[model samples]
Target: MSPIIENFEKSVNTLLLVSTLVATVTFAGAFTVPGGYNSPGKGFYIFVICDSIAMYSSIIAAVALIWAQLGDVTLLLDALHLAVPFLGVALSMMSMTFTAGLFLAVNKLR
Candidate 1:
């Protein structure tokens, strides 16, 4: 393989590695929700929902990463293009998490 192909493979491998870590972390977080939900407030529910979305999005990202590693350049490009929506889902989940955190903080002071 050429130097450029080698470099691209390395970059793809790194992306897969980081994506795996993110999936692991987000999936772990799904089990460790904030406030324990003993009272089941709206914020807690939102947190759980966000965590679920993040977990699923991370799962899709992992699939996409694997997809990207397989097949030729055209296939890789198609797989990575699919990953963009998963990326957006992950980003929205992060934003939801922040909003949930703020909601929790405010409720705590109430």
Candidate 2:
């Protein structure tokens, strides 16, 4: 219950909230693949890949947070640090997904 531990908890809580929101958004995205509502699309694979990465990374972050809560005080920092890579991957994948969608749109318009 030191100030440092308290601050760490606050940060972890923030990360948990963010990871959960990402998971929710990706979960929703999974059900609504790109361009499916309008026309046949070639970016379904990109959408699925990005959604999978986002969903799994967010889940991993959540699990790491939960696990951190159950162990030594130092575990929280380690968990968050470890989770950073997953978040990075998710972010890159999400960017790629958008790029793929944009490319598809350009191609379709041509």
Candidate 3:
């Protein structure tokens, strides 16, 4: 492997781990919803939407990372570019999901 590819491998490994974790957590969050199913407020809807987005985006990023493993320089670069942005989107959405879930949970106490 070239030095460039080797460098990318390290990054790919890190990103793959992150995307996988985000996907798993978001998938779980989808089921164990905050405020329960009985009360569907704005925060509940926001949590649902953001959780779905985070889960799907992270799954896509994981797929892209798998593609990056093909070992072709051009393909690896393309896949990395695609995966990184999706990973970022997944992470941001995950944060939004957490905030929304918190809001829903806290609001339920009022």
Candidate 4:
């Protein structure tokens, strides 16, 4: 195979792994909400929104990267282009979710 295709495969694999991990973490976050569900607040709501965004974006990224795994060069390039931004969004939203969750938890402790 060409070097370009080899590189694409490696990148796709790495991105797929990252997207999967982000989705998994965010999915888990949804269940064990900070400060519990009994006392809903702005921070809690933010956490939920951000977590959902992160999860969905990562899932989308994973799907796109999967498309890249198909043996077409043009399709691989297009899918890689699409997946990268979604992965970035997912990572950013995951950070926001963590921050919001931390804020909620800390406020609860205080």
Candidate 5:
């Protein structure tokens, strides 16, 4: 295989591993915390479910990216599959980070 392909495979593998670990940790944390999702409140469970879905989708996307990098399919097809969940993960992470940062900034200003 070409050096470029080898490097791409390595990078995709690394990303897949990292994303899988992060997803696992996030899911575990969400489940372990009391009232994290089990609270008798509005939308708590829904939020937890959505977070879980996002994390899982990220992991799946990472796996697909790695598989594509390993030369499983045409480059275009692989890219298309990878792009969908890559965007999903990116959007989810950015939204969560921005929300947390905004909350912290507002709290500090108060």
Candidate 6:
């Protein structure tokens, strides 16, 4: 591969590693923090669930990227594997919005 392609692959792999570490740390923090889930706000729950899913997805994508690199998968397959985490992020944002609305509705009812 050309120097440019090699550099790009290195950068992508580094990003995947960093993202996986961050997700792991965040998940650990969620467990360690007190009152992490006691809030009356639905947004908190939504965020927690979203974060959990996003973290797992990121970890999966990172592993998939490593597999692709080792197994000489097609570039398109590698790209698709890398792109999955962004979808998780998008879904997390949607969950945040829906959770906020749900909390507001519940509060109004009470």
Candidate that beats the other on lDDT, 3 or 5, i.e. the better one: 3
Order of candidates by TM-score, top first?
4, 3, 2, 1, 6, 5
Candidate 3 ranges beyond 4 A from true positions: none
TM-score of each: 0.75, 0.78, 0.95, 0.96, 0.57, 0.58
lDDT string for model 1 (1-110, tens) is 67776676676676667556666766776666655557488888888788678767867876886877875777666766776578668767867876885677567663
Candidate 1: give its CA RMSD in angstroms: 2.6
Q: In model 5, what are the clashing residue pairs, if there are any?
A: none
**Ten residues in a row with the worst lDDT in model 6?**
29-38
- Candidate 1 weakest lDDT stretch, 10 residues: 30-39
lDDT of 1 at 13: 71
Local accuracy of candidate 4 as per-residue lDDT tens digits, 1-110: 99978988999999999999999999999999988998678898899999999999999999999988888999999999999999999999999999999998899463
Alpha-carbon runs more than 4 Å astray in model 6: 71-81, 84-110
Per-residue lDDT for 13-108 in model 6, tens only? Answer: 776676576566556644643233556464666656655666666666666656656635376356545645654563464445345445644654
lDDT of each: 0.71, 0.75, 0.91, 0.95, 0.56, 0.57
Structure candidate 3, residue pairs in collision = none
Worst 10 residues of 5 by lDDT: 33-42
Cα lDDT of model 3 by residue, 10-81, tens digit: 898889999999999999999999889887778888999999999999999999998888878888889899
Indicate the residue-level lDDT of 90 in model 6.
36
**After TM-score superposition, what is the CA distance of residue 37 in candidate 5 from its true location, in Å?**
4.8
Give the Cα error of residue 62 in candidate 6, in Å: 1.0
Give lDDT tens digits, candidate 5, residues 1-110.
67766776666666666666656665664555333333433334444555566576666766676566646547635754574567467447635643443443354353
TM-score: the better of candidates 3 and 4: 4
Identify the runs in model 2 with alpha carbons over 4 angstroms from their true place: 37-42, 102-107
lDDT of 6 at 67: 63
> Which regions in candidate 4 have their CA more than 4 angstroms from the true location?
none
